[model samples]
Target: MINDKVLSIILGGGQGSRLYPLTEARSKPAVPIAGKYRLVDIPISNCINSDIKRMFVLTQFNSASLNKHISNTFHFSFFSSAFVDVLAAEQTISSDKWFQGTADAVRQSMHHFLAHDFEYALILSGDQLYQMDFNQMIKKHEEANAEISIATYPVNAKDATSFGILKTNEENVITSFIEKPKADLLPDWTSEVSEEMKGEGRNYLASMGIYIFNRDLLIKLMDNPDTVDFGKEIIPQSIHEHKTVSFQYEGYWTDIGNIDSFFEANLGLTDDIPKFNLYDQKQRIYTHARILPTSKISGTTLNKAVIGDGCIIHAAKIERSVIGIRSRIGKESVVINTYMMGSDNYESLAEIDKKKINILMGIGERCHIKNAIIDRNCRIGDDVKINGGKHLEDKETDTYCIKEGIVVIKKGAVIPKGTII
Candidate 1:
């Protein structure tokens, strides 16, 4: 039913500094999510469900893992013209600089758009988790026949200052936009909605950072040497001169930019009425389904938790936590409200004694830990108690300090036996 040719370009190149230890080795987009899936899976799955097959993932910072994951998980047949490809920074005829911003990333990958002969370019962030029928947005874009179309969502006025808010006219035409406005300077939007909806008290419609651009306009905008970014520069300029339409989106959308948000987003999955459904049969979430055996949960006391495949919960007490694939919980070990990721060959053994049972907690096999986030592939010896979360001090470190006074282990770090960090 849609006629406009669209090319989906995902900006997956951010360093994700906000996620620190998790982003130490892997790119933000490649960071694991919901115990089994990666951050990029959210946007890719959204595109798949929306029937947008052609995709180009732009990567720069620590892209090897991301590229491998994309190649292994997303595969298209030769018969199909649509394909998903990873676009890395390369020496081009124009310039030899790395991507400076979102617009610059697109500008660098102009060749991909030119090759596809797309009429519209759909730009999205790879780190956001949401479910949207972009085809519907594309249809609305075509109906409006505007130079640009942005997906907008209503946020409380109190939270509006955190996002790029836009003011639209009665015809859904964007009149102005402000990025992270002060509370006192926030624009009012009561006139745009119906009288009954006015009492909502001027809710600000903020940009979800999802954009649909006329391919020609995008090319023109990118060609302008002065334009640096879509939100910071190009969008503001467009609203001033060009006709831009706003497509209001009413759905679950969350940008998992930090550890707290990431943890909260993962916890959102276990809700009785989850906002994001990974098990939608009609809109299946495609991943590299590991060829591991079913999980063996014997004599385990799990309460309100999520356990992955090939895991063995041997008489362990887990509550309100997410256990990664191939992880093993030793006998009588307690895990609560944590995110654990491990390989398929992970193993653990707990040592029990007459007086007090020694808990051998760790991420990978042979790694002993406790009250700490044992990074991937760490080796810990028996009788070692890593007090990663015990000492509660706001030391200048690049890791999340949980309110429970738990220490966070950075990725790819090693902890020696009997070491208490």
Candidate 2:
């Protein structure tokens, strides 16, 4: 059972340079996913589902959209003590600097966290996709009597090098921590683990970056002025001094750290049997419900596509795509293997015909966009082709960017007719 003694802190990331133009106008958590939900919604919804309602999201980057979305979406009943809040980085008398790193962000916001009456602090990442009942993790923390409990996932030898590896005692107390060790160094470290501990045929235990810390221990660890990052400086140092434990988790988890990962995750949602199920009624992901009309289409062929509300389509062929809200697809357009984030506002045909704006608000006629990401409020003219060549290259331009062969049209960009990539 969850009580009011726990406080959840979600680390909304910094400028999110890896996500780039998607993060151009908004923070990474504010970036839309699954067509309807923001990235921040995932962690917050998980907290609510776990009956852990006292939460704070810490962000220092472009936070306008993130703030607006959180304010509009989560509203607890007045009779309950549950609430979700945003703690943007501010310059106070005690600290004049911005958030230096993950731990530093928590350190700067420690004052806000201290004001609340909570015994345990749950730390989460804002840009991850997974559904976890943190109540179980809290229970494990209580059983182990641990000062710090890390949620870990098992990975095969091939993928273990990319993550921070863990070695634990028979009781699952973490004995050592290694961040992104080489492949050759991993076998020696993981070989020490017992077969019973290596469940699911995986040889290595990787840190999920989800942690449960005793409130006092978190404060004590953060008091160190030099510990800026948890994985790099704090956790590695605390393993010996603190009662740290590991909770092995078996579930689907993806970190949307870069463009390729983000693209693949969104596209993976359209699978016949998606690894991450958004349609799970028991643990539903919450978002701001936009009161818009149902999407309308005429003579269109859509295959395994997820379209959002208030979209108007005219004879377009869309396949394996996630179309966002307020999208308008013109006649004879074909969108395949793309994540189309639709417009914020609607531009009627009359508005377009009157030349109120130079370009339309959505996809123009006779466009062929494949394996790309069309960001919010883009204006693609007719006869536009965005299919990159067979070979991948790291390319960038004023109107678009091609990272790992996935072309991304910039937000609110105006691409002229007859353009090709």
Candidate 3:
């Protein structure tokens, strides 16, 4: 068991521009995932499982939703030393500007870190999905007696260009680090191995953006003028100065920054032997369990789907999809390869087309939705057809065309029924 002398700082400030309609009203961390839980829940759950109770979530863009979610979901006893809080942007003695980068965000929140007496600071991204025993990483950091420890993973060289790759010796001491190196510059890890082991391989370890920094060392590094980001600036610069170590993680970790990646991550949940299992009794992934009854999936043919609690699926053909909590799918609706969230109700008489539907939903019983992302609480009218094949210019709304031609119904907007787009 690891001691509780570490503070986990979650970076939840990204704009999540890639998510578009889903992120328009909320920060990236606040965005819903796996139908029931939000993206930020993953890291928080990991912290709880790892027995690290003292945590802070830093936020900036569309932080209201993120703040509200954190407040409602994470409510630990204040009498105890353990607590979780959301730290928003504030005017500091140093600057009044918004966070310039990941390092800058931590630099601005330095006062919070200084107030607490912690030995190490574990910085994590709020948008990634993974199941990790950070206690192991912490123990490694302590054993290595290093100023910094980063969680690294081996990926193929072709995919290495998208990550901050690192070079380390047999002792796991990082010698060099590069961000998104070209294919030609990528190192062949198998080259050093014997000919018997020198088959076709593209294994190169890359940083997973999960860092455990010695408290004093982190403060000193942040004080430097050149340190801008942990990946782009800090780690690369520190390799020449500090004893930064790398901890290899063979477990599952995914960055859900884009739509395709987000879709794939959700699909992973349905796997029989999924890498990230939320249902493990020993390592239960904790979320704010809704006080609702089990899903009422009557008259629905659900195949290879993940249905959350309190969902009422009536006469709907939901195949290979994920339905969130308290969402009602009405009669004769066909939902395929899609994800639907809570606080939504489909009309009983609505006929939904499966092939054209992506992330579509209705706000309430009378709302009609198709081939579009209806934001939270959007009251779409009955018989409303948001039909425009995957890439139509919406100059009127000043929104870029979706590749799949998805029509987005903004949250809380009352779209009249029978209205065709």
Candidate 4:
């Protein structure tokens, strides 16, 4: 099978400054999403469903938690070669610095990749939310005898400016490329999309930043030290010289590039029919198999809410929210439009009763939290009111950050009683 001859490299992006406190302790791929799963799970699960078992994730900053997560989550038969390995930026005899860019990361890690026997490399971004069958893309690449294949998505003109636009010929072969082209330049950059996409005013094809490179070609490109990025340096320079084709994909794909996008992606799971389907059994998202008790709720009126395992709730109402594992909400609390990442462990009731701990690791009584993200193991005191909206200005405190009206309580933060934001 072609899958056996394919290797996957998922790029865990740089410092992730846009994500702020969320990325402070972990790498971008290690950042949690949809309550239960990490950002890296999306790409790895896609490869698993496609039967591309052997994979490597490359990350540089704050990779300790990322490494630990992968080590604990993915396990295969002892006799099989299936494995997922993380390769952080390392100092070798040739280079002594961190990974400069996407291409440089691969270049620095080429020694490990070359040790494996593979004909093609399926490069993917770790921070994207999408499900795709990579087998079809590989098969198409073989049929076209293309040296490189890029996944493209049809987006509207308004969104085209934010992405690297590709111009393709009638054969679906890329002819030219422009990175974040101006609005006036979009008229010439439109590509052939399906009737459904055209009707949706999605005539422009945006590069999805997913690519497949023939092993030999990737090796050749990596040798050039000057070229340090795929989307900026490799794709544009190689399109006219190499047989590069575009694989147009029409699906629910969103890049978790910033706090706004990340927050929206999680809350979208609460929709009646979400664009990104998490309930599809055939294409299920894989994650750490934790042995946890079933979530328990009382006096909580849940409407369009997704509660994860091992939650103990007493909230008056939870609407349009995602409550994560081991979450605990107190009486009369009203939580709306929020993503509450649950605690890592239940605080010993004995400790709380003994007053050994002042505030417990959960929301307190009579608190009203809206449009906020309470990260893992946060402690909220009683009678607190946090109303996050566009009316709030962007600011950062020791325990929380306000960005675009979303109040993100940092992990392990302690909020005093009778507080308001």
In candidate 1, what are the lDDT values of residues 1-421, reduced to their tens digit? Answer: 2222888999985788877677888888888877788888877877887778888998889999889899889877777766778898777888798888888888888977798778889999988988888888988888988999999977777778888989999889999888998888874542264433346553678898999999888888888867768889999999877789999876778887776677778766766678887777766667776788788887767777777787766635666667777766555555666666655354333233443423233432223334444344444333334444436664434433343354555553444444544
Model 3 poorest 10 in a row by lDDT: 189-198
Which stretches of candidate 2 lie above 4 Å from their native place?
Answer: 191-201, 353-355, 389-392
lDDT of 4 by residue, 97-205 (tens): 9999999999999999999999999999999999999988999899999999999999999999999999999999999999999999999998999999999999998
| Whole-model alpha-carbon lDDT for candidate 3 | 0.74
True lDDT of residue 387, candidate 3: 50
Residue pairs with backbone atoms closer than 3 Å in model 3 (clashes): 390-404, 390-405, 391-405
Candidate 1 backbone collisions, by pair = 361-369, 367-380, 368-380, 388-407, 389-406, 389-407
Tell me the RMSD of model 1 versus the true structure: 4.9
User: lDDT scores for all predictions?
Assistant: 0.73, 0.89, 0.74, 0.94
* Candidate 2: 10-residue stretch with minimal lDDT: 191-200
Q: Residue 299 in model 4: shift from native, Å?
A: 0.7
Whichever of 2 and 3 has more TM-score, that candidate is 2
Please list all clashing residue pairs in model 2, or write none if there are none. none
Model 4: colliding residue pairs: none
Deviation from native of the Cα of residue 146 in model 2, angstroms = 0.9
In terms of lDDT, the best-performing candidate is 4
Question: Estimated TM-score per prediction?
Answer: 0.87, 0.95, 0.86, 0.99
Best by TM-score: 4
Residues 171-217, candidate 3, lDDT per residue (tens digit)? 88888887888888875431132232234353677789999999988
Q: Give each model's clash number.
A: 6, 0, 3, 0
